[model samples]
Target chain A: MIPLSDVTPSALNNVTTQFILLHMARANKEPGLGAATCLALVADETAAVHFQFWGSECDSFRPGDIIRLTNGIFSYSGNRNALVLRAGKRGRIEKVGEFTMNYVETPNISEIKWVPEGASGRYVPESVVSPYSRIFPPLR
Target chain B: MAENLLRPQPYLAENPLERTLRESFDTNRRILDPPFPLSIPTPEEYLCLTRAILYSILTEGRTRGIRLKYLHAIVVDGYASFTALTASVVDELFERLLDDAKEQIVWIAGEMVEVGAQGFGDLLVSLLRQVVGGDYGDGNMWLCFEEASLFLRKWSALLEEDGEGRSALCCGFYCFLRLLGDHCRTRWSGDERLSALRQLEIDFCTKMLKEQFSLCMNVGRDLIRMLQDLVHVPEFHEIWKDLVLNPGAFGCPLFSDISQIYRIRTPSRYFLLRLTPEMERQMRFLLTNLKLGGQKRHQAWFWNKFLGTNPERETLVIDLIRFVCCAHHPTKEVLHSDIIPRWAVIGWLLKCCRKNYVEANAKLALFYDWLFFDERVDKVMNIEPALLLMVCSLPQYVAITDSLLEFLLLLVDNYDVDRMALITRGVLTSFDVLTRSGVVPSSDALTSAEGISPPLKERLGALLLRKEDHSAEAHAID
Candidate 1:
């Protein structure tokens, strides 16, 4: 369990955190995976991130749901062309609560660019792309 | 197959309480019936049996009889933890409960009452809270009917036992009295079941007021507020006459005048009887967590989820108003922080009202405390928000300021003509304490607000300028 701000682009299914879903886009089908995927803006008290929901996860969550992600991966996906947070093959997400958790929309970690550090292959935030999600804007 | 206690939603983790009960039931499945083990189990096994029994009773409809028998056989702690766990299920999972599961919960509540289980009163109160005040949907109305029937059926069982039973009866009286105001005045009165439910509620409330007047008095002045709405009903009309014209008829010597009811501040818990736990949670979250400017989204969510889809829900605004004013008092840190104040949330709720009656009732709820405020007993917090709301809405939303001030004045003059002086004194003291405590800088802001109409200002000015005649006023009321 960690704050969303601590998550960096990673291939390993190790990021564990909780966030409230702020905004969600309509689900789209991925031909290769034969499953539906939805893009959503999720946040915690610390920071916001772009969360990708795969398969039934798309229909299982909605705006205002507080979700807990276990062993999630935060890395760039070529299809979305963005650094997104997701429950990869080895990870899972569950709806924990709703409407009570505090959240921030700014400092979207997914919008920040990341670069791999020397030989360690660990990624670090390189430069800012946007302070908030470009795909799903903040509520007025 | 047994039904799931709560409606299954995708990707949601299992609730630990349900898991405990389910696992226990699974572990004890073969032994749940007949030929009970002759051995007295350890404390841990006792708890496991209780959980298993509760789970079986809730989910296993066919074997409910046998499961209840098992529960009775292993009773310890006066069924305290068992009833409390049932209440948690009601409070937490009720909204998602399948229809059959809901029926089972109500049936078990009746069983709990029959035996006078230790915490059955609280279980009944929790069920009562789940019956939304203004909801007219079939499910909501069905709950209303079932709970009303249960209260009527279990009236004696509720009264025969200890203090918890009596207090739970008080809670029922408060809830049904308030609910009857809705049930009697709705479009669904044409429906037979709703009509039957209305009659049951009226029967229970009228019986409480007529046969058990002393217990009804324990609910305080809000009793009159709820009763006033039902004056059109013939039964309550007779009760009202006795309340006002013949106080002796109630048979309580101390409660001779209605002012006595007015003087005793309605305890905060009575206000909570009207709101669902889910609604209470969202309101508390908005007031305690969100900042003033950022509340729009949460308010939108609250509105859409609770108030948006139905016109009848507009009436819930009144309950929300009273709940916010009487029930949820913020701490100094939350109050001092950028967190939204109670008045702001109230102001938004006022604007949410789509119907005239709802708006008026909401305003009355907001100012009901001010009509009978006693600094000795009533916290200034209750009256503080109305004046602050009036002051804050000035200049730009001048109409809000004007209407609220006009309503306050109207209430002083006509809320109860016979008790005008009491109400006037209450209003004056409310404004006085609000300013004196620096909740607002001065009363001049309201009295001198340019947007306020002239005649209304004069009435307010006259009321403010009137000298204190404590002895004379007390004599007049007495």
Candidate 2:
């Protein structure tokens, strides 16, 4: 398990973390695939991220729900052109608690631009696309 | 593969308490037969059996008789562990339980009360906390009915059962009196079930007040506040007359005057009687942890969950303010930090009131301590928020400051005509201590603010000046 701030852009589906759901967007259905997905803003004490909910997950959680993701992944989506945190096929998510955790909206991991370091091929922050989430602004 | 105890929400982790009970039941299912082991079990084995039996009582409806029989036979610790587990289940799993499980819990409570189990009072208090203040829904009303019936049926047992006997009823007394304030409202008088429940609550409250006046007195000043709401009800009207006119009617020797009730500050625990556990948790988190500007989302979530469902729930704002002002006190660190202060939350709650009466009641709850505040008895924190709210709201919201000051002045005169002097002294002392103690820098924020209306200022000045004249006379005499 790791804090949300430690999550980096990775395809290997091994990010385990917990956060409170802050804002959720409307569910959208694919034109041909008929699969539904919703984007949500979730944050732990350290940082915030854009979390994509697939299928049944879209309606299962609401704002103020504290969710724990097991073996989750943080990577860019092919269609949306934005990075997101998700529990894709080999991962899981569960509601653990609610309304008790602290959070920070700045340093949204999803909005940062990551670049591959020299030959080690590890992702590192190259530039800031935005300080906080552009899609879901912080609640004043 | 086994029967579950709680209704499973998607993506929600199973509560460990429920999980342990379910596991105990499953692991011991085959052995729960006629030839129950005759040997006395070890303490650990005793806990396991108790957990399994409780789980079966809630879930295995067909074999509940056998489970109860086994439980009665093996009771060595005064049913302490069993009742503790039952209380925990009620606290943690009551809202998420299946409908049958909910019924089973109430029935089990009846069993606990029937047998005079240890710690049964806490179980009853936990159940009472689940009775929401402004809720008029069928499920909420049903719990009210069942719990009220349980109290009425076992009244004698509750009075004489154990060491926890009277105190538990005291909790029930506080709960029902507070609840009756909502139940007796006219808008919901048409509902048959609510009407029945209201009658039962009146019967129980009147029985306690008439038969056990001292016990009712244990609930302190909030009892007056609760009964004040019920003055229009015929039965409570008679009680009110006795309270105001004939203090001897109550028959409690220590109770001489109504001011005695006013003098005792309502304990913080009694203030918690109205809030559900979840609401209490969220409010505590918001006040203790969240910063000023960052509380918007949390506040929205709280309102959406607790208040958005019913218009009647706006009535709960009054109780929430009382809980915040009296029950929850922040430490000096959080108080001095940028954490959202209690007064801001009260100010927000004051704004949330949609009805005029509720708004008035919320403000009254905010400043109830001020009317009867005695520095020797009452903690300064209880009166701190109203003063800070008045001072803090001066810059951006002069209306909040204006209305609060006006309300304080009005309450001093109108709250109790006969005891106007006492009420005046209470308000005067509240302002003096808050300033002298440095809770606020000075009263100048209110008295000398340019934005405040002159008429309200004149009244405030007169009230404060009157106190000084008396003090000066004492000095001159000395």
Question: Model 1 chain B: which ten-residue window has the lowest total lDDT?
Answer: B467-476
Q: Give RMSD (Å) of candidate 1 vs. truth.
A: 2.2
Candidate 2, B1-478: lDDT as tens digits? 5677777788998789988998888877876777898889889888999999988878877788888899999899989899899889988888888877788888888888888989888888889999988888878899989998999898998888646778888889898988888777748878888889999999999999999999888888888888898999999899999999999998999998898998889889988888998899999999999999889999988999998788889888989999999999999899889999999998888888888888888888998999888877899999999999999899999999999999989999998898787777788888889999998787777888989999998888888888876455434433
Q: Give the DockQ (C-alpha) for candidate 2.
A: 0.90
Error of 1 at B202 (Å): 1.2
True contacts kept of each: 0.76, 0.96
Give the CAPRI class of candidate 2: high
User: For candidate 1, lDDT tens digit of each residue in B1-478?
Assistant: 3346778888998888777778888887778888888788788998888878888877877788888888888887888988998899889888887787788889999999999899998999899989987788889889988988898898888889768878988899999998888887888878898888888889889889877888888898899888998999998998898888999988776778888998878889888888888889989999999988876767777887889878888889988998898899999999899999998899999999888877888899999999987788899988888988899898578899999999988898899999888887788778878888999998889778898898888888788887367436755655
Query: Which candidate achieves the best DockQ against the true structure?
Result: 2
If you assessed candidate 1 against the hidden native complex, which CAPRI class would it receive?
Answer: medium
Clashing pairs in 2: none
Q: What is the alpha-carbon lDDT of model 1 when measured against the actual structure?
A: 0.86
The TM-scores that each candidate's chain B achieves against the reference are 0.97, 0.96
Candidate achieving the largest TM-score: 2
